[model samples]
Target: MMYKFLFWLWLFIWCVQPKQSIAQTLESTSQEFLIRTISQVDFKQLIEKIKTTHPLIAPSIEMVRCIAPTLSVWCVRYTNRATLPQFLTALHAFPAVTDIQTNHLLTKPRGRLISDPLYTQQWQLVNDNINQNTLDIDIDAEEAWQINTGGYTTHQDTIVVAVIDEGVLDSHPDLTHNIWRNTHEIPDNGIDDDQNGWIDDVLGWNFKTNTNNVNNDGIGHWHGTPVAGIIGAEGNNGIGISGVNWRIKLMSLVKGQDEASIIAAYDYILTMRKKYNESGGKQGAFVVVAHASWGVDSLKAADAPLWCAIYDELGKVGVLSVAATTNNNTNVDTEGDMPTTCTSNYLVTVTNTNNFDEKITGAGYGKQSIDLAAPGFNSFTTLNTGTYGVFGGTSAAAPYVSGAIALLYAMPANRLMDSVKAAPAQTALRLKQCILAGVDPVAGLQAFTVSGGRLNLYGSIQQLSAYYGLHQSASILGSLNAYPNPIKEHLFLKVSLTGATRLTIQITNLSGKTIKSRQLGTLPQGIHRIRLEMAHLPNGIYLCVVQGSAGRQVIKLIKK
Candidate 1:
């Protein structure tokens, strides 16, 4: 009789649970809604039209505001929340509206918080075999620091990274020296000194209230401070823990817990970066990396097209965005997570790992979507109250990658830096390639991320160094290009020469079997285009070795 009663009780609870969840979702959906409209539609005129058409509910309409003007995204709020369903149905019928989504609340994943100040406790930077943890599971930051200290670049350009979250405590003792300041704008002058449209954004703009105050609230808005510290807290300081880049600029792009505010913050970052690129890096900030440690869970890219599209826009201006996957253990590929699932080549998605170099049980993973993992569990970092604390989650994982990118930019390679200035987009893609190619392979991440590895700062620096060494011309070879790489019948090869030398081409398979060999004797000092017919070669991978007077360079080719 007791077993029968327990079975009925289980059934009763299961049936009632979903009803409660449904009611909560319905109540939450009634307040605000986000809509994407056609660009030609005047947003203010539409708001007036809605007020005139809905006479009875017009007085209850709280506010209508533009979120992303370029994307034509707007937020509509109503005081009479019960009318949202009908209002949504009515708005969907309009031709100008392309897509709509319930304005879901954006949140940072909560992590276990603890207070610790000793650098030895920061096992994420360098493992010391404490508390039965694995050694060498860290990001190899110490070794990378030997190569570049994340301070100024060889050209002495100040590298800036934008932290898009609630807000970063710019006054934090460890972070104050590294915080980015807009010298062009005057403080508290109530004027747009820089003429960037934002009034007196001396530090960074706060999109939550459209103000210059970008400090974190002492409430649950505690994620951004640690994130900024992780990216760039003043290193070698005797106060708290060290960040990834010791002498880097951290720009605080404050956001609210909603999509509108996040989009607006991105707009500010985009404008500043575009200005930097257009003005020859004289006026605006040199923001190469942007870190976003907060996002919506279970949100698909299809529903949030405008949000996903911003990553590409940021990339064109030479900014690489790093996003943390949801803290949930579910696979992001199957369940879908925003920004991670968004198909943008410029965006690097990271997941969380622990001190043991293992994916934490609570962290999200996706073999196809996630790029790599980082040490995020129990990471010792700076806090909003000018103290230190241990924070965990994918939120703590992403900034490590962002910092690594900034450090790579500081490497003393003039050739690489010139390439970055000439072709910002292409160089940004190359930077992403270096990071993905340099990750340390981890057993836990083998089936989880595209890199199948965890972040290794030293390995990435070495990879970038090797790339710079390989591309070095010694004043002989200017450039080498191969097109239609995955070839069918013919391959086009272009070689730029600064001096006369015998040019030889050799094609070899992976097993070192020479498939083709040719010597075009005594080329002049100019660009030479040659065609090779690979119609007889089978569908496989081959290496095209180009030999010149200076040295030999290898280019990987595919035939299909």
Candidate 2:
């Protein structure tokens, strides 16, 4: 009788409990919601609500099962080698194929490959042993000098730097002011007001969901915010870490963990460029410096076509793409990642260096592909929590270079376009020069970097200021000109050798290593023409230094 009573009591308690769907329970609580199973009605209703409330959300509802279990399959597309009909036939033939679509592609498998044990050990040491104080080499005073003495003044004209990563924390105090504004679209209007391929790209577009909700979900990996901080954190706000160019705008393009998503983001950047050019709205020199931190270890030639196409597209419209060198410590020349190996003249491939300013052990090395190196180990930068934290990777280092480029471009007003256009080569030359001009000889100039040195922001800015200022006055001393700025096969240099007995033609990038050196047999009096055959040269910027018996003249050249 007691057992029967207990059973009846248990049944009563179970029946009286709340009868709510998992969605309702998850929606009403603060815990993370993982949608496992949904009734057809609930799923349809949820999608409809998303469409009505968040019109920019373009959900690719179809699911595609992957061979790997841990990988989150998003979307799949047909490769160039396979026709649509063939792909469809294959999909129909295979029972394992759950779903397929054309809007996006699945992310590469997150495979663990053999890494250098020594480098991995070193990384562990850096990760576990280093602190903020140890990593923060006092650059505040030097940074101040660059801003003040180097003629680095904050201009009201804003430059937009697109952070193509996971997403951004829109509410982050340090980043809010710098976020890009979509003036054409009204918020929550459920319309593509801008009509620029995105509905409401107010804080920037999210290609992951093909939506406007480009907010940091706090769990999707905090890649974008740190990158954003490196580029344009609010300066002099008495807040967290300062960005290289705080006055510029920050555009957030949410790229998911897939190549197709990245490609879509790239397309969005191009779209913005077109809009900025055709609109005639602001008329200021708008520069979009995209910071891409994602890469893989495999060397696939087929991947080259997409990257090559994107690279050419970026080059045509004067967009600078800065990519992170893979952290695999492998030789990039023999086996490199896409986009970095795209061989585009406009793309600036950067590797990682440590606090000691030494090349990070795991950082990818390439005598030909990598352009420069920047501090990446134990890097102290802003996080999505609106605070500062320590993170390290070639990923972190790429943005330092990207931010420097933005700052360099921000210096000149009327010549902003030309300045940004000339930045890659100048940056490359500066890196090369810094390495060559290093204090230690045994460290060996070439051993430091491909360009052969660390990133010197102050020196590069000083050089740019001196170079462009002279051009403004119509003076020949500062006007070192190169023809076919984007040189395909040959680069011609026109200069006036005024009272110079011997001239040494030195080509270097930002790191200060001499890329191309030629001792001009002799300078014949006045206006002279020197030709450089760049048939085998990689696409990038090279600083041509005409060091005469009298003095030195530096000119920026681009190799396509």
How accurate locally, in lDDT, is each candidate?
0.79, 0.56
Pick out the ten consecutive residues of candidate 1 with the lowest summed lDDT.
Answer: 107-116
Best by lDDT: 1
Output the lDDT of residue 515, model 2.
Answer: 77
The TM-score between candidate 2 and the true structure equals 0.55
TM-score of 1: 0.63
Candidate 1 residue 375 C-alpha distance from true site, Å = 0.8
- Measured with C-alpha atoms, the lDDT of residue 403 in candidate 2 is 73
lDDT tens string, model 1, 90-146?
Answer: 564466876666665442111111122466678887663555667457877765654
Model 1 ranges off by over 4 Å: 1-117, 217-220, 470-560
Candidate number achieving the greatest TM-score relative to the actual structure: 1
